[model samples]
Target chain A: MASDRTASQPESSRGYAPASGPESERGAGPRAGSVQCTSRAAPAIGAPGHQAGAGPALHDLDQATIVARAQNGDVSAFEWLLSAHEGGVFRLALRMLGDRAEAEDIVQETFIAARRSLPDLAAPQSFIPWLYRVATNKCFNLLRSRRRHPAHPDAFDDGSVPAGSHDAFAWGEADPRHQGDTCGGLCQDPALRYEAEAQMRALTGLLQAVPAGPRACWLLRDVHEFSYTEIATIVHLPESTVRGRIARARRILAEGMQSWR
Target chain B: MAMNGGKPRLGCGRLIDDVWASIDQPATIHERSCRDCQSARAALDHLEAVTRSMRERDRGDAAQRPSSRVREAIMAVARAEVRRSRRVPLATTPLGTIDISEQALNDLIRFAASTLPGVRARRCTVLRSPTPQSSPGGPSSAGVVDGGDVRITLTVALSSQVRIPATMTLLRERVGTIVQAQTAITMQQIDIGVEDLYDA
Candidate 1:
């Protein structure tokens, strides 16, 4: 019944490409003039001037120079790269897999693989997207394997958190001191905080119902704030397909979240 | 336009997809004046808000950082792999050969150079003496000869307060002694280049 209804929906609503879409729809790079929906408030991964605690000399070096040094077997440079990127990689893994230990393992494996192949990377600018691709692929493989053998009953088929997991719902409840920066003074009120946390928990529960592929696209777009071109490159999908998956995921989540309105 | 659920469509006839797209993109002429698109956008804006909130929460989580143990393990693996791929021949016997990693030699030279009062080693390249029978026109490779003489070139950054000639003499002596002591190979020559300068 669901498939039938989906098939009946208009192609535009399903996010299929129009007969003559904009040039940016042709899967060009970030410079192709596509409208990036999210602002990157955090320091860009691998970009210079963001190395807070690195040595003064290393801090002054750009990412390309650092990558070149690492390629030449500079262990200190590699360590600097790891320190800069490990957190972002871990968060990506955690969101995709919903298991902390497994996510940590993915981070370790990704960097080791990167170290082994660093010499072969032809372009230094592609390092961030390439690293993300490695981590995302590992998550995809783990999710695929989980489907074959259901080890954790609480984790969904797509590896998202179960509705009952308190960790999934807690938000800032466990440590009020760590309330996220976005909530500001509104979250200072206990009543407002509780209400927001409840809403977040409900929304997260709804997210688990989304299949893995679309969920990944949605998370990369909305949460990580990757441009559509970057998402397509990381996930190894065409730009149109990425748009379609994100749209479908959003429709499902919005439908499920109607009650919150 | 078609509506999937039984929810009211306000007063406009545009599809809900158009409304959602308009939330993230510039609105079309029709969407700008349409009340239905505005209402649907307001409703859909809630999802965007929650998603942003979740992103912030994820960022603020202390647990998101990889553990120190994990970092150490990654570094250990990387060092091992890099060393394994690059071993320089130190000595050879009729029975077998003894080799040291190029990285180990570089680390030794860098450490020795760093002991100087105002020098920081940036890079170290070791050139091993070619075997006696090797072709002269062919490429000269490191780690071919057993107990061969090795040439060392060390790049360093110096403090503005240091004298260049005295620092270079001290650096060459220190690196030569350390390399000879550690590897038992006579240094053919040691060349030091001051590549950068820093404030004292």
Candidate 2:
């Protein structure tokens, strides 16, 4: 679907008119904390901060306050909550679905469903994980539907198989020459960044071969850095099962990614 | 070397699970001295590196914000949901009854309340007054009456310096006047609660 084609456009530049009133002042861009790359050895993708686009009055309020207000049926507070988490939700969906439009649909559905059930969410602190659960279930449904109907046959058809083995380079985008280049801090180099992105695209394509359950577990654990316990709650699986699935997924991807070493 | 369910067995005859476990936790004594386990761990480390790199680049490249059309559609649905769920009875005549969206009424009340120098609206609920024949103790539901008086419960955060009595009276008067002037619905009661205090 050429999902990455819009990669460079800042979200605010897109024509979405922010809701009128105080929320309009909230920037519609990615929260700064979400995008910072951490140490690779033990990367911990922190919970998203709610500081972006906050007006002076709301600036001091914590996420719990915003959630509590939303629970009290404050639409503006809900909108702020939406704005804060939409980016993370969208990225999760995109990685899960690999289609831009479908991912966007999941984001819309997730928040709408969330609004309907927000009153029932007892703990304001559990909002993020609850939100992720909502999003993950939607993705699972879509994936199940796709498996039944085969809507996009070419979505996972990377056609990268070489000779007898599934070489990493055979996966369309990444080149063999860049195999060992970690591109860790060199992401600032545009050429390296582009290569890294291409490799990521290839990795996403490879993920299609993993079963949906393990795929989700792997993404939540390895990519998003959710704790195993948190992932179990989000995916509705036992903690042991979640760990097993993640290990199985790693084994599968490692075999396919052998050439990268 | 042998295979366990198509997975390569380590030279120590351990299954792939051992390699994964060693990488996930601190290496056991045998793993620290085992060449096969070390080799497997090195390969897994490279895979982890690749996954981490993918995550970093994916975050960098993925669209950080949803497109405008999607945002508008989602918010439109949200606003509609709020209006649908919380409509308040405005009037009822022989011809028909008129209702006002609770969201709209809340917006009006909030705006009116904010005009006061030291108050900020936190939450507002408009409840329909029970018809006179109903049980006096019966609960009054929102948007239930064909045409009748409405009760408003507004919660606000007040600035520390505002005179409590005067601010409360002024807030009540302003809110009552605005609802009456705009919607022509008589206010049976205006309950204002100070839920928080903030500096002016």
- Pick by DockQ: which candidate is best? 2
Q: What's the lDDT for all of these models?
A: 0.61, 0.62
Model 2: per-residue Cα lDDT over B75-168, one tens digit each: 8988777766556667678988678776677767776777777665656676555456656577655346433556777766566577666677
Question: What are the runs in model 2 whose C-alpha is more than 4 Å off?
Answer: A1-59, A150-181, A184-191, B1-29, B60-65, B85-100, B104-130, B133-200
Overall local distance difference test of candidate 2? 0.62
Off by over 4 Å in 1: A1-55, A150-186, B1-21, B24-29, B32-36, B85-100, B104-200
Clashing pairs in 2: A160-A170
All candidates: TM-score: 0.60, 0.63
Model 2 over residues A167-216: C-alpha lDDT tens digits?
Answer: 12222223446545766435788887776666565667777776677778
What TM-score number comes out for model 1?
0.60
Candidate 2: Cα lDDT at B36: 66
Q: Say which candidate scores most in lDDT.
A: 2
DockQ of each: 0.11, 0.21
